[model samples]
Target: MVNELYRKQLYFPFSHESRLEMLVEKERKRLLKQRIIMHIDMDYFYAQVEERDNPKLKDRPVIVGADPKKGMGRGVVSTCNYLARERGVKSGMPISRAYRLCPEPECVYLRPRIDYYTRESEILMQIIVEETKAMVERPKFEQVSIDELYIDVSSLRSYKRAKELAKLIKRKIKEKRKLTCSIGIGPNKLIAKIASDYQKPDGLTVVKPNDVDRFLVPLDVDALYGVGPKTKMRLNALGIKTVGDLRRFSLDFLKQNFGKFGEDLYLMAKGIDLREVVEGFEIKSIGKQHTFEYDTRDLVEIRKVLLAEAKAIDKELNDFGLAYRTVTITVRFEDFETHTKSKTFALPQTGWSTLLEVGWDLFKEFYYASKKRIRLVGLRASRLVELSQLKVLKNETRRF
Candidate 1:
């Protein structure tokens, strides 16, 4: 009867073997608590790419984005070199504002070359993996973005070797790609990510387990990940300006005020992040959106904007070597009312054609249903799966 009860508790589709595998995986991940995590962040990625391609642009301010047409351009800056940053130019700043800050002959403005940048990113990632593969049995790596990644070298069991590996990766990238990256080593992802930015351009910082508190305490609470402007203001109101100050509050008190996020804040203040370094790249969604200078009811203009966004997202999907099973379209009216519609496919799709076809249909449904002028248009692809993983799954299914 006990055996029957236990067997009945097991859910359908999860065999006894699979259940045992899940338990084994969970135990393995829990053992990673003592992991040695290393984070790599390329310095001024897009702008540096431009500078590398043109030696003459070195030491000069280079801004890569929409043409900053003498303080009258519409789009925002994609990225700017350290020199442009010194002149108060920032990524995501309006091109008009970027021009105002670092105007004319002083700064070189150029549009983004997405394809070239993607190619460079792929080559750099390959170099990192190939250079470090032989050092340990299997160092788990995760690419967070085109220019940022994390590697788990817990198998090495030495911070000294971790730092050495970081230097080797950095040197190899600079040698082969003419690029520089900053690296940070710590006991977990949160500490490593923050340490990566502790120093600029070419930097390597290591914070051992015993030094986690010292490395985190004196810093402002805003230095903790996920503490944005609003959260900082709330923390400041509670007289918690620094991580040291935050340690004075009780975890229960924090949870009472901020709910689930408060627990994260409390843990961060203690420099305690138990999250493991998940291997491989995993993206929930990729999207692009644009707000028009003026709201209009022109379908031709709307389709053009959607098409451009679809093309950009398609390139991103291709760059990541992934495909999507869902397409979603978002439309915001002039009065700030927004609506979204989505379609999911039985099979994953690649290329912009799918987006344009499904997105246009979804938008027209809304356009005809409502009598409001459109202010913004957006396209998003979700339910992403790596193309290689899909092929493997297909092969396994065929064996059945």
Candidate 2:
């Protein structure tokens, strides 16, 4: 009787392995019906760079970001290896908190060397572009941020063919750069992006067109792009906890709750994304920021921080052959309340003195109101125009 009960629990009344085989066969058939897309993401990019250059650091926990200062430091973690992540350390967490979690004396922490990483990334991208014949989009070389990319392989003949191409890209990148990447193949960019993250640190996942529904059904609503904390809370309250639940709602019902974004959410939950990959992308913004260890209202320290950030931004822009038309300053108060002030100049400026002067003025005029202690300060320059365009502007502005 117990054996019978076990079989009942494990298998349906049909009690045939053929039934299970049929299910698998059905899924295999469904997965073959759509366009193939792929998203590629580098794993622990920065930390891996450190390990690559310094072999001794290999096989040890590595954290790459700003100084930890013995658990009394400010700033956030950029990236940490899987080993460190296992200890509850994560990217974007407070470095101090990471220290508290792992507390290993030998845990390696290193400042980001953007130049080195950019060169390494170029090598990786070259290999990918050559192997897949796919368009490559890159952020500015100097920024060294977001070491992830999307490759549209829909033009490829088959999903199996794309998987073979993905394996080659992975092999070349690993052999040349000594780093690993997780790749996901699907019908659209959204599905590809989601599938890529389903695995990590050297993984490959392929989702054929027919498998999209089953693959997405069990995922949480938060998995949809653009759904933040506030949005997730609202979704949960509305009984939309998973993508399957979201699919049940009519477009009109979703729009009623979320406006146009709701419509977008509904479409995404249904695995409908139509974004195309574009190559030769330019940097949208250039900036530097720092979080303080303690919140302070002292203008003196704040100004110092602003100047340092300005200098860093100036150097970064210089390296990238870019210039900024607007200077933005961000202040985060002790309670996590944040505000930003920006000033757009008629001309681009890369000089440290000019950037600091304008940045200070913008902060004084916009951010000096409250007695709230500031826990973080940041400087950003946006509305970027090329340095060559700045030269043309300078010549045009000169009086005849």
- The TM-scores, one per candidate, come to 0.75, 0.76
CA lDDT for candidate 2: 0.78
Minimal lDDT window, size 10, model 1: 1-10
Write out the backbone clash pairs for model 2. 37-186
Best by the TM-score measure: 2
Single out the weakest 10-residue window by summed lDDT for candidate 2: 135-144
Report lDDT (Cα) of residue 244, candidate 1: 96
> Best candidate, lDDT-wise?
1
Q: Give the runs in model 1 whose Cα sits over 4 Å from its true position.
A: 1-33, 291-300, 307-376, 383-400
Q: For candidate 1, what is the lDDT?
A: 0.86
- For residues 1-400, could you state the per-residue lDDT of candidate 1 as single tens digits? 1233236546536766455334433433453357899999999999999998999999899999987778877668999999999999888877888999999898899999988898899999999999779686689989988899999889989999999999999999999999999999988898999899989789999988777778989999998989988899999999999999998776568878888888778667766676777888779899999878778899989999999999999998999998999999999886777899999987688889999899999999989998999978899999998988878767776898
Q: Can you tell me which runs of candidate 2 are displaced by over 4 Å?
A: 1-35, 53-59, 134-146, 252-260, 314-327, 341-366, 387-400
Over 1-400, each residue of candidate 2 has an lDDT whose tens digit, in order, gives: 1123234444545535444334434433443454566788898899988888899988888998778889877888889998889888889888888888866576888888888888887778777777766433331111123577777665665788888988988988887778899998888778888888888879899988878889999998888899988999999999989999998876567878999897578668767775656554467888888787677877899899989998888897888888888888887887777788888888887778878988888777645587778889888988888887888889889954
> Residue 125, candidate 2: how far off, in angstroms?
1.3
